[model samples]
Target: MVVPKHGVFTTRENKVYQMKKLLVSAIPALALSIAVGTAQAGETLDAVKAKGFVQCGVSTGLPGFSVADDKGNWGGLDVDVCKAVAAALFGDAGKVKFSPLTAKERFTALQSGEIDMLSRNTTWTLTRDSNLGLNFAGVNYYDGQGFMVSKKLGVKSAMELSGASVCIQAGTTTELNLADYFRANKMEYEPITYDTSDETVKGFEAGRCDVLTSDQSQLYALRIKLSDPNGAMVLPEVISKEPLGPVVRQGDDDWFNIVRWSLNAMLNAEELGVSSKNVDEMKGSSDPNIRRLLGLEGIKGEGLGLADEWAYNIVKQVGNYGEAFERNVGSGSPLKISRGLNALWNNGGIQYAPPIR
Candidate 1:
């Protein structure tokens, strides 16, 4: 039999000998020590680095939000946020794998660590922020819930849809808001719930519900998916405040800061007139904000535990906030939605970020 050094046995005979010598009462303590050691390994950033990429959670398929083509190529504003994080971490926007999740599963996925971050169109709520052990990085898309109905229904406003069957995604703020909106207005409506947005669209398209309700942005995206896109009309009334943004697990302030600043970097890039098209040129500008943002004069990125050029990578690879919005859901795409509340603070809208200084 081979003897073991330090009483750490390798061979089966030595293991049996050690087991015989060791006290059974100590097994629980030993197991606890192993558990604690495993847990102390590291947090999300270390795990993300070890894996060489960030795992981002996104919608299953919502054009202008997140969608995968036949070749598994992902696109949309939410996808861009994940890409920006990747650019910050790995300097490669393509260094990410998107796990498409439904509204019902998004929170649990983030809570269980199935995803490093959730870039899906999720709303920030008091209950979620205070109870879910998650943090909202920042508002990426400011939206409001609205109703869409076929032109044949002759419904011109949400107030006219009393006792209508509304198709809504289960496990979403939209569902809760729908109830609140109708109750406040002293109206009535039946709800048809589905697990995914696509399913909700399908149910609406199939005439299973008289109306479809969601964020105004989503109503636009889903309207285009209908068989007769022109036949559906989104009501003018904007109900319930929906401030959608990316989310990360709680307990890791470092990772939270990284995600939050990645978005803020994009917002500030737009405000500073730095874009993927001219980011390199803007790096040489005399403006201190531009220089600091582009990593020419400051250590902001390093402060976030990232490369000094982290914001530069995000702007170089992902473009500014306006560019992403216009391309994904604005005039550049089928949605053609105007930048109502999403415009920069200096412009006419409220999309503002803290100074890079």
Candidate 2:
């Protein structure tokens, strides 16, 4: 493990006092203005390195994104991204500590520093990005809000539902979006609100609701829990743009860069044809891009406070972005989300990245 060099809190006196080291949560942050002048000292990278793990905020129980097994083994799309971050930091993907939170608690958790970063399927919006003091590092999943209705309803499209009672997760932006959509179109809806996704799915399946509304990706996961999944169909209307990305606390630039670049590195790797199974052979290849990406001859990784071969370590340990997507949600996979918007820009999608150089 690469341990960062530590620094001490500057003190002028010859002796250190520890008897009354008291901290008050209620103390006005006005006191902090006196004791501290700048944004918290070192970046989050150094702190995470010193702590030996990345505290990643994730979804509570999204199946293809962040679900644990009976033995507590975590494996999913978001989990893989966290693992990739761990690999970039410590060369070992197992060093991540996943902290799951509900939609209501997620942003608050990141703000309070309860988690180092948020790898949840959080939508990046103006309010979240600017008003809430959070930064979206990069988009990992390109998604949009959609409707899922049972085939028995015979609803071919979302526009067909004028008076349908929809089962929708209560605390998310989906609720507001649904309201606006229905109101603008002059349609009436009975919103069957639920505190959690499971409850919403249950409400839809138990004949309590004729439709369910949420992110298209989430609807795909929720569809499987139905007794007759084939009886339901997700409508083609994508109501809103949900650019899902890993978010970091606003103040730490270095930590945010590390997380952001780590995700871009994975995307770049896949675009360059670098895969986990063949990274070893490519390590000694003749391609200049490959050498630069693997940090064989470039000083790229050092900028992110990581080892020279950070990208190589991530691809070797956690696999590429496509591999992560395929393992969790793809053809022959359970969550089967299409690569429509998530595909690379070269492949007629918008998932492009800046040059590493």
Q: How far does residue 198 in candidate 2 sit from its true spot (Å)?
A: 1.0
Residue lDDT tens for model 2, 1-357: 753344353442333243235345336556545433332545667778888999999887888888878988887888888889999989999999989788888887777667888988888889889998799999989999999988887889888899999898867889989999999999999998998788888888898999999999999988887788899899999999889989998888888888898899889898999999999999999888889899987776778778898999999998888888888887747877889999999998888877676
- Shift of residue 260 alpha carbon in model 1, Å: 0.5
Give lDDT for model 1: 0.90
| Residue runs of model 2 more than 4 Å from their true location after superposition | 1-43
lDDT of 1 by residue, 250-350 (tens): 87889898899999999999998999999988977999999999888867677898988999999999999999999999999999999999999777889
**How many backbone clashes can be found in candidate 2?**
1
Candidate 1: C-alpha RMSD to true structure equals 7.3
Q: In order, what lDDT does every prediction score?
A: 0.90, 0.85
What local lDDT score does residue 156 receive in model 1, on the 0 to 100 scale?
Answer: 87
The 10 consecutive residues of candidate 1 with the worst lDDT sum are 31-40
**Model 2, CA-based lDDT:** 0.85
Clashing pairs in model 2? 151-231
